[model samples]
Target: MAFPKELYNAKFVEYIESLKILYLVDDKFKVICDDYCSSKMKTEKYKKKFEKYFQHKLEFENLSKELEDEILIYLIRKG
Candidate 1:
C-alpha cells in the first residue's frame, strides 16, 4: 500500500531499525518481535492495528506536529 507521506519522523525509523537488528542478533527479542507479529496475525483486529501502525511508521515521512506527539505518546504508553 502507498502510505501517506506525513506520518513518521526520524526516530521512528531508527527505533524500527534497532528492532530489526535486535531481531537478527538477540534471540530473546527476536522471539518477542516474532511472536508479536504472529499473534497479531491471528486475528482481524490486530491485523488492522499492525497495518495502520506500520503504515504510519514507514521510514520516509514528514510527520505533522500533532501526529508526532500522538505517536510518541502512544509508543511511550505502550512501552
Candidate 2:
C-alpha cells in the first residue's frame, strides 16, 4: 500500500528536519542523516562538504507495536 500523500509529505519533511546540522553555508544549511533517503535533492547540494555530525553511531532498534501507546493511538484515532 502507498503512503497517504499528506502524511507522506509531512513524514518526508519531518525526516529531513530531524537531521543533525553540521554547519551553515552562507544562506544555506547542511545536515546528515543515518542514511540517504533518495536520489531527490532537498537541501542545497553541500553533500560532500558536510561531514557526519553525531559522535555516537546508530544502534538498531526493532520497532514493536506495544511500545507505540499514545502517539500512534492518537494518529490512528485522527486517521
The whole-model lDDT of each prediction reads 0.63, 0.38
For residue 66, give model 2's deviation from the true position in Å: 7.9
**Per-residue CA lDDT of candidate 1, range 1-79, in tens?**
2222222335447676575566678889766666665554566677788999888886336466668989999999999
Model 1, position 20, has a per-residue lDDT of 57
Number of clashes recorded per candidate: 0, 0
If scored against the real structure, what TM-score would every candidate get? 0.39, 0.15
- The prediction achieving the highest TM-score against the true structure is 1
lDDT of 2 by residue, 1-79 (tens): 2222332345467663332233223223232221232333434245533433221222212234445666688999999
Model 1: how far residue 44 lies from native, Å: 2.3
